[model samples]
Target: MSKNLEHQFSMLVREVRKEFVGNGPKEISTRFVGNWAISEMKGNLTNVEKFMISSEQGKQMVHEARTKMVKQIYKKAEVVNKFEALMGAKVLRMFSDINIDEDIAMTVFVFEQSIESKGK
Candidate 1:
């Protein structure tokens, strides 16, 4: 995919996350590979979340909540449809995880077809 296309996709993802998560990552980068779009995000934790992660139990809870919240948001038809339209392919599944210690997150979107080829 062209760099411009990738940037646009990243921006869209950031905006969607901000809308749902209340705060978006400070930075996001995306790469298209085969039928997948992989996004790496940095500075995803809020100040309160950062404080909460000081304790072992708080760390686990924050990790669980952050990861599960992302998955739950993707379950909404509007969210899935937005991604499908952006990729010009049906979204098969979405997987996401967050690292509380690093304040980083990774989100992978699987498309039914080769979105990388389509972009080119």
Candidate 2:
């Protein structure tokens, strides 16, 4: 597990963040374990977006919007190619979720095979 692998994962996250949010988060951190990479996003929302996601209903709405965005983005083969290139592993699945209370989002990327040692 090279730290560079974590950095590559973080870069992939920031790139994807840009697609959905028009810009990357203030910070993106990633950890690799087994066949999974977990990305933590900070400053994931603007002031107005924060207000809109303040309540339970707002949170649900935002969650659904994020889900839709994920689906749409996954349709781009270039995006998938970039992911595989950066990860050095075939992506099996991806999951994204946001916590309005924390103003943070976490995305999990599961690979068909382990990337833990591939980047080393």
Candidate 3:
């Protein structure tokens, strides 16, 4: 991607990710891989999240729950449309993962066309 488009994509990714997380992350970064936009977020855990994820079993449960939540969100056409609008491409797929213990998350949004191709 060109510098301008890269910057724009990064900014939009951060904004959208903040909305997804209910609040913005303490730190966030977005990168491109083929036609995919990969966003990573790190933040402090909410008290409820912290309390619920105290044990190893609890951590696994919370992580699975987070995965389910993201899958549900991606199932919505409106959500996909919103991302495509922001990303300037048709979205092909989305995948997300979270680490409950580290309070970190990674989400990848795949577009039908490469971002670099669009930039050129």
Best by TM-score: 1
Worst 10 residues of 1 by lDDT: 1-10
lDDT of 3 by residue, 1-120 (tens): 565666666666556555675655677777777798887878835567788888888788778877887778777787777778876789888888887767888888888988756665
Best-fitting candidate, measured by lDDT? 1
Please provide TM-scores, in order, for all candidate models, with all chains considered together: 0.96, 0.85, 0.78
Better of 2 and 3 by TM-score: 2
Better of 1 and 2 by TM-score: 1
lDDT of each: 0.90, 0.79, 0.74
Residue-level lDDT of model 2, residues 1-120, one tens digit each, is 577879877987787778766877898888888899888888877666778876888888877887677666766778878888887678878888777678788888889988777756
Per-residue lDDT of candidate 1, residues 1-120 (tens digit): 567778888998899899999999999999999999999999999889989999999999999999999999999999888888877899999999987888889999998998786667
Taking all chains together, the TM-score of candidate 2 against the true structure is 0.85
Per-model clash counts, in order, read 0, 0, 0
- Pairs with backbone N, CA or C atoms under 3 Å apart (clashes), candidate 3: none
Give Cα distance to truth, residue 36, candidate 3, Å: 0.8
